[model samples]
Target chain A: MGIGSDMYRQQILDHYKNPRNYGELEDADIEHVGENPMCGDTIKMFVRLDDDEETIEYVSFVGDGCAISQASASMLSNELQGRSLEAVRGMDRDDIIDMLGVELSPMRIKCAVLAEKVAQDGIKIHDGELDVEETTTE
Target chain B: MSQQAETLDVERIREEFPILEREFDGTQLVYLDNAATTQTPEPVVETITDYYRNYNANVHRGIHQLSQEASIAYEEAHDRVAEFIGADGREEVIFTKNTTESMNLVAYAWGLNELGPGDEVVLTEMEHHASLVTWQQIAKRTGAECKYIPITDEGRLDMEAAKELVTDDTEMVSVVHVSNTLGTINPVSELADIAHDHDAYITVDAAQSVPNRPVDVTEIDADFLAFSGHKMAGPTGIGVLYGKQHILEEMEPYLYGGDMILKVTFEDSKWNELPWKYEAGTPIICQGIALAAACDYLDDIGMERIERHEAELAAYAYERLTEEDDVEVYGPPADDRGGLVAFNLEGVHAHDLSSILNDSAVAIRAGDHCTQPLHDVLGTAASARASFYIYNTKDEIDRLVEAVHDARQLFA
Candidate 1:
């Protein structure tokens, strides 16, 4: 289990075992759901904005998926607090991978990035740049 | 040891597959992902290389010597596959790209013309995306209704529900011979009888069955049967669709241009013979010949013995995997299923389990196995599948169980 241990780091497992900010937020200012169609991993992100509306006051997520996906969502939710909506949207694949603290393969990369995509797509929908439909990370 | 294992020279059979001898890091490869595709043995591989080396030419066209040899070998491949599947003659066998193409061929050429708004097409809940999606799109185009035979709690098709579903309005009944995810061996012959009683055409998607067991199209009295070579120790890009001669004669061509024509004028064109009429353009020449070699190889080992070997493996896998707590194995009892096991460990997603198993050099499938609807019915996002073939062994299954235990530990 040498290589497998490396892929599922202690930090990632902690996040997966005890996910932070995990659940639906009541009357969220922003809400979006996305799914990895290939593996059926889903993440629905919810955000409550600050008075400025550009800043994220609270964020939560609810879904079922592999360890990488669930852990990434938990880590991403922890990172969301006190961050600007723009900053959250600016969060890229590298930021999520850095948060997870593990190297992912091509297929695992999708699981790692699903949370980031859900957050970004939610912001886009809130801004009316994209329609409010269920997004998919095919 | 299982009685089937005693009859089969598994040690000798394993030697034919060099890939099985491969080592990942310090661990050996324990490949159990046979449902997706089987690894080709040396003989089939040699057949492929031999074709290109000696007589690599376009089939059924040129007057040259190379074309004659290539054409004869290609036609013989058809005869071999027809005999393997118990088709009447080579005329009943038509080679296409793969099983999906075969399903599309029947859907477009038969369903589109025969179905109308009131017409119904019956299928099972356990169909792979190949047949399910193909028929769904066809139903949309033809304004026909699509009905699915519900599965019982044990993951077998609900035959009681089926009799209620297939009425006079039903025009077609397409079903998978084996469930790719559940590993349930559907009673397609019984389904065929029901379809026939209702005067509906039945097509069997034998992609999972033909590679692992003896499938007789004549005994089933099927209108059409589809299977892929890649899943049967043959090369990719080749598949067979066996249709009764009279039915194939009545249907229009699915593809056009090139060799599938009698003659063509500026105004119109007449079609070619039975199988050729459906396969337009240049067919998979070497792949077809290599597929025949695969059939010959399976025959030499005996398909009944192969079927028995897989069933024994599946039962063993089911029992071993079930011994672990929170490990839910899907499908029927060991004796009732095909050569695979679909399962999940609690709190450990299939991808994670698959990745952990890879650390031990164990390869298994982790996804919906192309049966999204079936997964939905099972109330799972996805599942992990360990499929067996002729070459797999009980020792490899033990390795899989050990890796799964390792995955459970890591997740826990």
Candidate 2:
């Protein structure tokens, strides 16, 4: 496969094969779930916040989906372990694509952003500022 | 393969579908997405364009000659389609937008009016969302309980489970005749018998079966049968919903407008006759004619031979796909399947597989196939499906195998 191919990039396959921070955290402070209704791909993100209440202490996730979705979740959870929740929630689609290290077709873009979304959703739920039902990101 | 060729002139059949001759990239297009929608042959296409060129007018409302001709053509479609499905008469066929609309018509028009809190509407897990979600919504509306007859490991409907599921509490049973995802052909006649024993009506979502197999509404003793026109070589925007005459008479109309009313007053309106009562407004005028043409085309080719041809294709495809390493195929045994195979290769997302296949000029469907619960049961988010049709060939199936091989080498 060509390196330039948006779908078969080395970084994507790497994360897909060896997804980091997979499984659930027992003492998680925030847990949120998100689903792609059209594809039936679901991801549940778990996060334990630091004493500061903003920085991520530890994070994990569990889900079954396409490489973009699974790999994107793995990479996102791993990246968030040392970052602040505000920094991640402030991230736009471009930031998530940058984290993915691969370009995505418009249709697959949601897969790349799903993890970022669930993390944000988790933070919102932790703060009691969001409705779990209303905020289940598509 | 040779035996299949003898029964169907594959080359001649391929020529009739204009899109079959086109090339994608450097490779000729090998379309196997027939379960989604079949490529319309030239005759059906011509029938549509011919209607627009010759008789362009609103049906039933106008008193002019154009309306008369359009009305005649549209009603002829009713006769041809009714005969094709073995309905009692032309009055049994009501034209709708697609099979989804037909299902909704039954749910809103019949289920809402007839069902109640204690009623149980039996369904199968193998149903597409068009069949499942409608009943689910109806259940929510009428306070009925929606029960499903789960599929066996081989993906066929569990008849043993079905026997237990359709009991006295069951009020109506809606099931898919041929599963779009699993490729299982359900025995509707048997299911209908069980439902009737409980004083329940059965509705068959024949979206996948009607175009590929021989369907007889009379033989199946169906209360309602629904199938889309586009899946059977006809134009889009038209579908057929066949209900037994008396049952349709009992149910109310779905949409209200121009042609469906017998008499209209400022206060209220009286509905029209049997099939017309169900069809409101100026329907898919040209599409109805084209669907009739499609029915005629399938008839001339002989449906039994078509069934044999597709069964052979499914068997061949299942074998070829299974031969590849890292691939997992889902569905019943070859003989029991209708005309498709759903599969996914290890380490490759079904969508990724679809994109990879597209590079080699092959077309296949990749998604949940609108059966999310089944996908949940299969423990996958989605799967790839390659469904066969009359014009598809063995070489094309080989191309599909090669594409999967490429995907395995790259992704797996």
Candidate 3:
């Protein structure tokens, strides 16, 4: 409505409008939920791991949240499919930020990264690397 | 409404807030999240510093002069808050952690005991989590049904639905005086009348209302009210819960031990007075004093003037935002709406829009704003909000419009 048409990229809105990999994973080996509380952005992430507990056979998410969070979740599910749990554990904040393809304020950085955090937490729980009680606020 | 009225000396007011002096993103810090929490003024900061520095003794327990001074300051803050909200007496105001805890106190102490099976607790869809979830928990515990009045397309409460929902089974009606997300100023007085007709007490969540407007508990005839100090330029970790004297006396204490007891012998203990009985453990003395200072500051500026100023600004923001072809605004398009705007760009996500605005040093809130039920009703998971306060200016609104235009461009 103002200047460049690049702001509302079709790819971004397309993923948001009709998100792929946007439902619950039945009998998930690991699951975790995180909420922003202030903004009311909630996310529940699910992970199905290989028998050896090294690779993520199937990853999915189901929750009601903002478009940014939903799209990010969709993107993460697609990226993390067939990827090993250890590879995602090695991923840093900068990697997730870069994947979003947009700048994020400190406050909103959480919204964009919330799904990743939950996914990592779920992975950690599955691998027995960390206890399920240890909640990460990433 | 004319814009020719003398503008508030925002520069002078800006100087009073130390946080405003800090630079952000190579620009002057422009904080638009007043609805979340206001920056503390120097006077209030100094009051807190002086209390912790000089009078650092536990109040109501020590006999030293420092303790006496601290106790007096704490009690004076209670009195100030009681007078600020036009309560019947100081005993009516009980200090809690914040508005959430204050409302929880009412729900656990009042709701758990008074409500039972077949009882109904009426609330509106526009309530914050603090107001909504507490009632939900109470309903779960007491087997009482939780009913909500739906919101209209313009984000106003549907009074027709409210009338239908409120019946003889309605035990209590807790509604927000002003919606934080939509900025719709609810008709609490009229709602109170409806609740009273059913012989039910009403509790008003004044978190958004008290900070922006003048609220008289007696005039509204609210049996209980909850608000936070931080929302009104006061310190965090402190809030006030105002309950009718008789109702408070009848309810059980929320917490146990410490100053809340009159006499204890390990067998049977008598609870203290109306306000003190509910306030257990060590109180937030310094924050309470700062809250009193904030009350004085608002009283000096005049709440009516602040409300009128915000109304004008809200109307101006609504008008300008609507001009953008892609912008979809939520809430009632009325001058009487509170000084907040929740909207969404055509294509960009609210978080992305908020992030881009941050790049331009234009602070705004983006999300469900802790009113998930209302957002669900509005058919969106999140929205970007630009809220106005005493320090905000029309020029800032212009900046916001331009920045939103920039955000739209970035995503386009």
Per-candidate DockQ versus the true complex? 0.67, 0.38, 0.20
Cα lDDT of model 3 by residue, B23-128, tens digit: 6646665678888888888888888888888997888899999999999989888999999999978799999989999999999999999999999999998989
lDDT of 3 at B151: 92
- lDDT, residue A126, candidate 1: 89
Candidate of highest DockQ: 1
Assess the local accuracy of residue B228 in candidate 2 as a C-alpha lDDT between 0 and 100. 99
DockQ of 2: 0.38
Residue-by-residue lDDT tens digits, candidate 1, B133-246: 999999999999999999999999999999999999999999999999999899999999999999999999999999989999999999999999999999999999999999
What are the runs in model 1 whose C-alpha is more than 4 Å off?
Answer: A1-3, A136-138, B1-6
- Per-residue lDDT over A65-138 for candidate 1, one digit per residue giving the tens place of the 0 to 100 score: 89889999999998989899778777788898788778787778999999999899889888999988658473
- Ordering by lDDT: 1, 2, 3
Candidate lDDT scores, in order, read 0.92, 0.88, 0.84
Backbone clash numbers for all candidates listed: 0, 0, 8
Off by over 4 Å in 3: A1-138, B1-7
Q: What is the TM-score of chain A alone in each candidate?
A: 0.94, 0.91, 0.83
CAPRI tier for the interface of model 2: acceptable
Candidate 3: CAPRI quality band: incorrect
Lowest-lDDT window of 10 residues in candidate 1 chain A?
A: A1-10
